[model samples]
Target: MTTLPTQLQHDLQALAGEGGYRDATERDVTEMRGRYRGGSTLVLRPKTTEIAAAIVSRCAEAQLPIIPIGGATGLVAGHIASENQTGVLLSTERLVNIREINSTDRQLVAEAGVILANVQAAATAKDLLFPLSLAAEGSCTIGGNLSTNAGGVQVLRYGNTRDLVLGVEAIMPNGEILNGLSPLRKNNTGYDIKNLLIGAEGTLGLITAASLKLYPSIKDSCTALCPVASPAAALALLSQLQHELGEFISAFELISGQGLHFLREHFPQLPQAISPPPEWSVVLELGSSAENELKKLAESALTKAIQKDLILDAVISQSETQRQQIWSLREHIPLANKKVGAIVSFDISLPLSKLALFIKTAVPKVQDFDGNLRINCFGHVGDGNLHFNVFPPIDKLACNYRSQQTEIRSAVYDLVQKMGGSFSAEHGVGRDKVSELLQYGDPTKLEVMASIKKALDPNGIFNPGAVIDPRK
Candidate 1:
């Protein structure tokens, strides 16, 4: 483990003041998923961007490493320090301030430390909507969302966090601030620097604040739980809904029976929208200018879908309580997955046309590798992303398949690549997927990423062993 130089520690303390730096706690240096363990001598919680910059500047001068963290809720081990790595964990929790809100422009400027749920609530208070949402919204910070370019259920409508953000203020590895926090909808002056840093995880810089785009408050929203015979039918239903409802289709999720079964086995208290849930089901959510109109269009669309044999049965939510309960079922699957334990988990995206075939072909391939494997496939089907996870046989434990992890992942990812899909979809390539990125990423694109990392962070202190590994 690299130990902080005594002199450098003293310097950092002086720069950040006594309250700024403290010994790293488990909370400061661990990942939410428990997939990785991180170690660091100190954790720095800077109250302001200026102080953050000062800390970065000193770290750069001293050739010390830094890990930029926010909320520490990321599934990938992006913010976790290495096993023996010594560095300062820079937390943005204190920077939790919504700087500005412009209802007229349908935008808001918020600091990186702002909780995503708070941002939603702030926009709601203004009678507007910031639609970048996920299960982690209550704890994940806007900065982490921007860092990973997080895509949630609403990607089918509002796009990812990158789409919701108009501008950002970041501190480069060298402590130089890039003030790109403009709320303009269109600025085609030059290269898109803000985007380059975004989704770069923290290798490029530390995002301090962002100017986010907001939408008009949702007027009429409708939710439905539709049971389909197969994934192909679900895709067809999605097309029909798009053709009929257009942009009103905010979320279209594909769920497998295994996910619901997991919930039933583990989280039985959670209500199931469907009593006798089908093997394959979908959660459809639509929002429009008029609730009554949206409900009519949705009902009409479902009727047509049912008549065409595209859907077997469906439950359209009649009230807010019903809608929330439907959503709760969708969101709780991941928690149940955790309790059940997974042999291997994958976040993959495919061409919409290839999604069904991929699932059909990949499931058997995984079973071929180990006949006892159970697959739980689910995610935002509207955007072609799926959280395809593998579990051991019902009587076995996850540890039973631990030795075959590489084979299991390869079976799924190889199929994903052959079908022209991404091995890593919305989940950014943190340390967990670095090898996969190197193996599957485009050669030229990887070369350019390395060049950008070198040019922007010559010291390689931003986030070592992250998206682009310097060791390579």
Candidate 2:
């Protein structure tokens, strides 16, 4: 729908209530990383599932594309509306409610618009843990998190957004409601529709609410910043720590010296934990119910690792404030990357054994494309996901290198494919990576995905150009 009828907004307002319809904010059009922006403006916020269904029904009749937006913290261009104006931008913001928290069930039912931090706070109130933590958790909504199947620091211990969700309540493309919000461990009733919508990036449907799994609140924990010699050394240290700490090992993050330099350059206010950060480092965290025992174990293990020369220095947190500071160092690297402006960033994953090798090989390959490019490689090493980003030299801006961006991206992605890794890991194949998915995706898999998209959203009105492009 190139130009929707102006009456459509009033029709949606009447359906979802006056407060639900409004012009889109700038944030609504731009993705989190500021890499991509859209031009649509019609925004709709429905309060309830019934109201959401009604809005979809009206759009379906009018054949208007409906872009479902959440907290708009997505790195991919998933939430941005189409290039053409007049598509209805449906937001789940008004669906902010925690309908249930059952300790016995070990689950919490949350509306799609509930801020992830709010859900964590609610679980904390119940003396339980939500286990999903992200830099954008304070603003990213549950809907977007689930939509992207987001991965964060705790994915090593728990899992991705799909792993945390038990069920979801969504509106299908034909304006029908999919009420699959059942908090069950084993419900072999049919196809796992809940998991289907969890990572579909809203191309499949507009998720309204979800039933999420919760865990026991961590009783005791330890956070450490261990500086290693190289990515290979960091991988070796991770193997040792996992053997020693086992499931208690909650997060194992790999950081590059380049990332630290970026941090110091951009965010000088953030306290540097280690002196002259090593060539590589890792922020290792352990969480468990046993008090004091985990820290003793960690301290002992770190001593052994030092003796083995696996780590050069260690900055273990002794207090909550200090732990947050250490984590702040890890979390702020991406912000620094954005400030420096990456020419191209890759969110790719490989087998645990292939990680160090891929990093080593991909670096020189990207540098070969242009020797002036500097790379920042880091992320959740425990889970094999790496946010490998390429940027310009310290004195240069990314815009100056824009002409070479496409070739550099292709070189990196081809290597990622040849090394038996994924081009898109935790970040879903939003509009940004849609073509990459098509280029590297398995033919059979793409065919099946197209089939599913056709079955669920035949009209192509549901996020038409996102995961799969609409028919010409």
Candidate 3:
């Protein structure tokens, strides 16, 4: 169904120059995470948007599928090439560039290949802030963030990548450039085209660059690790803090005692604040422009909560080193779990009030598979998002517990559905969750998405088997 002509290959090689393209070796076919593997005929890395466009246009003429890859950090197998199709892998690694940082407009225009951390650093250099902070910021690209509409620790205050984007420039399936990179605060345009491509996951188009919104850097900040009784108590404390601190409450992350236990057992180098961990812990952060009175405000707020029994105990970070240590504990849970063994990670969201009930019902069902099965629960409680991961059991009896993955997933998802929650919250449904999407996604919404995909990419050459399959 796909063809790669000799002339087009020569032209691509000429345009990209030496060492820009490679024949897909057996190792390259295997994915970075070892979850999804595919055989790609060619891996093409274009240094500029022009070269990428030319390669894409030639492929369009030849009817060859093009898979756009950026950092390959996505949890879902969204970037895996199909075995049935002859595809050209478009790696955006060569397109790494921060074109401009306009301080006047508080906008940072960066190529899709630029890593999220690099973009944040560029913004920080100008005394500005790009508040899209994720665990994978070190390796994930801006284009991947834009494509996935990534939600991270700062989503409570700054919002997701979708909210932070000012505009986007992408290459359509027909190899036409859709340049909509305007840093306007308000625009009554005919249609918001940037929104379409922001979360399309390279299914509709290849995101080339983005104009991102930046914020004024915070001069004063306060960080606290507080122990709570339960999820309800955590939510109650968050409500009280929001009432007191208002917009200064930048991030409020939740972690279970089990999650903390994992860190203590696995990451022994990280210091534990509480000797006997409470049922739940809340990592609260406040950012402000005024530096003089931040500590007093934070201490006073914690004192009030402590008196009311909302928080059992608290530890405030006194220095930047201490703050980083506390954060490292929160950020390294996923990696710690990975080192231990395989896990079934879920990014689910539920109603703030029903979070405790959902967890109460789901945790036991997951543990029923194996008693020693580690349930590492942690996420942004302010937005009701939880990264509920189930680690493989350590005992011989639980060796084949992976066979019950389907039952475990069903139990968790059923509880979420009963609570009127989304199965896939921040993470988009890639090929891994297509069946779940079809089961839980609204029929009318799915129909509209199918129609849009059909309209944009009739040939279905762009990232097939991603969010929606055309054949279905």
Candidate 4:
């Protein structure tokens, strides 16, 4: 619980001006998906890192909990605040700025509030690539990406958000600014503090800015939509294709027939590249910086795959427009499903070898709760991460099956644990999964995590109830 000092609030308002703060309504503290609800006394949108630091210092003195928010697009409910606390919703929207773009170093220094798409566009303007991408790139902020250590389409090749970040400048709970923005590729002087804050989900600190690594813009590329017999076949094709294409393989997404069905029903605008969907579909992309015979190589590799019966059918994107269109279908599935109603979304990772079995075992357990339950499994199969989503059944009686959430989650998470996988993969263990994490995570690991939390945030003033309980 937190109690705000009226004098401190007035001082902060004076420093940031009248427009910098707002009294957070009940609506402001609730999550975007409405799965998690919270309340806060005020929402502060500081325009600069100094202001943020000052706000943090004031809150620390007052012992108030500060919940940092970006675009609020996270699946883990990481941005929610508690009602008992005088929760200060610290937003970085005003801090959005592309501070510098060094073409020579192929690096961009950006404020945390900059949208992921804007950063990509900035890199593109410099003939460089910021390859971290997802459906929420337009809305999800760079800070949120760093906080979650986001993994998206290009995780197979470019790696997760943690890989792209070269340095981070964050404000620790004690109001000390940890400045580590070095664009140098090699730094072995000491411990890597940047990584600690990268996926801490605002528990350790509030990320203000980052120096991000960039890649040479891909000049040649090929995309294909293929129909496969099953997830196993898709994995096999991925392995064979990767062995042949090597580093050229950028994105390989596996989509189930039911996932495709949702896209077709909700998003009629997207073109279906393959007819009469097989049990599974794959959207694969290959890219290269220097111009090469990419199309020929892709076609030949795909031809070999088809001949081997690894792929049932395939459609290659002839042009850039076609590639984007194919990607739209893959990206729009989540948004399309949201229009209908709520969903229990799981972002889990299993070993590539065990993905097929994990999906097979989990689907039946979910269906046993409601036979007509809509299970849409799709994600970066190359990275062994899948977005396993369960939508409510069409039948009203069937839709009222909330009681099965625990059983279904346990079944899926248990399989993930058995396979040496993470129940919370790309998504951090926010309040929503704290209990599950306590149950599944190693006790020793949790102890170390708690020790670190105590070391950095002794007062527990930063994003309470996130990642781990400070009170514990």
Candidate 5:
């Protein structure tokens, strides 16, 4: 199954030529979650979109699957192809280019392979901001971010990756280039194909380049880590802060006591904002164009919340160093989770009104399912997205609890469904979540999606097992 007919590899190599062909590396064949392993296949790194289109065209003629491997930083198993699947792994890493930065128009264009942090740096160079951010920004590429329509810390204010994209230029299933990277905000001439590809997770097409929207750089900001008695108390404080700070509130994260414990156990020397971490706390950040204005507003809001008995203790950042220290606690929680290991992790979102209720009901239920399990509940609370991960007791290993993963997921996901929440939030439904998507996904919507897949990929040559399986 790993064989690509020898001649096909040679043909692909000739098509890619010289610098385009690269030997398979350990990282390329493995996914982030350790769920899927890629098969031995030709890895083609096209330097230009034309070469990419030609490669796709060649694959289409032979009715071969094409997997567009973006940054390999995807949480879900989207990029990895199994042994039975035969095709070329097309990489856009060599397609790194900051095509244009229109300062006057407040937009930038970049190829798919550029790392997200590099794009942010380019925008910063122009005195602008690209608000899409995630923990893996340093490694994840812009194409991967757009493919998943990733939501990060600033989603509470700037919206998800799709909202930040003006347009995208992609290669359709037939290897034809769809030039939709328009700088204009308003264009209603045809079908909204740009959107279809944005969150399609590369099932419909391979996104090559994008025109992105940018925001004005913030000159000042205020950050604070305050303890809340419970999720409900955090919700109350969130409302009060929104009323006081309005759109300036950039990020609002909920941190759990166990997360702090994990950090202390692993990274004891790391600077922490709250010592002997409270049972529940929230990190709130506000950004503005004005100089030294948001701090007083944040202070006034925190004071009112404390008086109202919503906040237990407030520690506002005094300097830029202090601000980073406070954020360090929030940013490193996932790394800590990785070290401690999780039995099962859920990336879910609920209605703002149901956030508190869902957490209150879920904690006991999950713990009751496995008495020894510990929960780490936190995420971008302002946007209603939560990364609720379950871990084993200090002495227990996650592998030992593998038998209960199904039950644990059912316990949490069923409740999420009842609350009208999503089982998959920021992370797109990759190979890992296909079953859940079918179980929880709407039937009518699924049918339409299947039809779309069939229409675009008539030969079923574009990512055979991704997003939607080949329609009958």
Candidate 6:
């Protein structure tokens, strides 16, 4: 597959028809975050599952690598084709369709190319909720979300993408179709192959559609910005809220002072949720069907926490507009981080008891590797995931610190491992974290993964270099 053979190109053109095939552009091969670029000669956009199957079947016969991309909003280089190899890009953009929405059954069937925001709107129209949410929801597609097993603000309550999806219909690397898109709650027929493909990052298969689980609509809700003295206090406050609010607690996110500073520095026009942000703050939200009950429960929890000095300052949203403004602050932290580029960004997870200590120890230890580095630590603390990013000093550019990337990454990852945490939490092991996975991954787990990959994709034509590399 080093070069696209003439016969293979002709076969692809014939299979995809005239308009479906085109020369790859810069946009086709580049990833989000501008960190990875790939080399692809041809791009294919098939309109139907049958057409996609034809394209994959032809490529499988030619033994050419195929890279699957959706929305191109992934942070990891999962969708980026290998630069050293010649491949074809397969996009699911034309597959956008919402086949079904059953409010009574609490399920929605969506095609791979349906944008996440549109899914949310559809659920809203049915008086239901699709709880998988993130800043990239506007552009990220359902296929991409399930592929990456994406996590977002509400993971504390609804879980990740894997939990939201009940079934999926995907095409195996060898052009075999797996039709497991059943909306059954309990099906113990055999091994859970649907779960395998959900988080495989397209290494296992190219997902075409899914049957997703939806939840009851939020009739009443409350959003608050709580300033705490430390991560320890933040966790304690979360515990208090959950004890009182129970399942009503929807989201609890941790924000560090450094992240707030980045927001103030870059997005000055945005209204601040909590002025003069504390050393550490949390954005807490609660939702319920009973109007006024959610806000009342939240207020009671905060009143007790404030009395105990667990929370210092707080701002509760009084209206839907204000609530959106508060969430805007939480969502824009990543944008601010992008504006002030990072030397290395980590999506790590830790045990609840270990989060506070890990943050305290890792910040200074990472900075010791390079005194001028700026660390921004924040994430969905309720679910034990953290986005720990390293940046250059205010006056310096990220490019200037490129040489220290390895050192910075090693410092953070080592600490995370030592604290009984994972190097990757939500973002999958794309090209960027392949080495990290090899280093930190369990040997037995790796062996099983390789076995599965070999059995399903023996020719190594599916997302060639992602998750697990092709055999040499």
Best candidate according to lDDT: 1
Candidate 4 or 2, higher lDDT: 2
Residue-wise C-alpha lDDT for candidate 6, range 320-386, written one tens digit per residue? 9999988888899999999998888999999999999998899898878678788888999999999
RMSD of 5: 1.2
lDDT of 3 by residue, 1-472 (tens): 2556778778767866767898766544555446678767778888888778777787777767888888788877777776777778888888899998999999999999999999999999998899999888999999999998899999999998999999998888888988888789899878888999988888888899999999999899988999998888899999999998888998999988877777777888888877776669999988975674777888999999999999998899999988887788788877776666555778999999888787788888888877787787889989999989887755532335657877888888888888999998787877778878888888999999998888988888888888895466
Q: Per-residue CA lDDT of candidate 4, range 160-205, in tens? A: 9999999999999998898988788889989899999999999998
> Cα deviation in Å at residue 270, candidate 2?
1.0
Candidate 4's TM-score reads: 0.96
Clashing pairs in 1: none
Error of 1 at 312 (Å): 0.7
Which lDDT values do the candidates have, in the order given?
0.89, 0.89, 0.84, 0.86, 0.88, 0.88
Estimate the lDDT of model 2: 0.89
Clash count list over all predictions: 0, 0, 0, 0, 0, 0
Q: In candidate 2, which residue ranges exceed 4 Å CA deviation?
A: none
Comparing candidate 1 with candidate 3, which one achieves the higher TM-score?
1
Q: For candidate 5, give the lDDT of residue 340.
A: 88
- Model 4, backbone clash pairs (residues 3+ apart or across chains), number: 0
lDDT digits (tens) for residues 1-472 of candidate 5: 3567777677777888789988778788887766578884578999988888888888888787888888898877888776787777888999899999998878999999999999999999988999888888999999999999999999999999999999999999999999988889898887999899988887888999999998999899999999999999998898988887899999999999999998898888788777788999999999986685888888888888989999988999999999988888888899889888888989999999999999999999998977778999999999999999999977999999889999999999999999999999999887778888888999999999989988998887766777785534
- Name model 4 segments beyond 4 Å from true: 1-5, 25-28, 397-399
* Model 6 per-residue lDDT at 429: 91
* Residue ranges of candidate 3 with Cα displaced over 4 Å: 1-8, 23-33, 396-399
TM-score of each: 0.98, 0.98, 0.95, 0.96, 0.98, 0.97
How far in Å is the alpha carbon of 9 misplaced in model 6?
A: 1.8
lDDT per residue (tens digit) for residues 145-232 in model 2: 9999999999998989888988899999999999888878889887998887888999988999999999999999999999898888
Give stretches of model 1 more than 4 Å off: 290-292
The stretch of ten residues in a row with the least summed lDDT in candidate 5 is 463-472
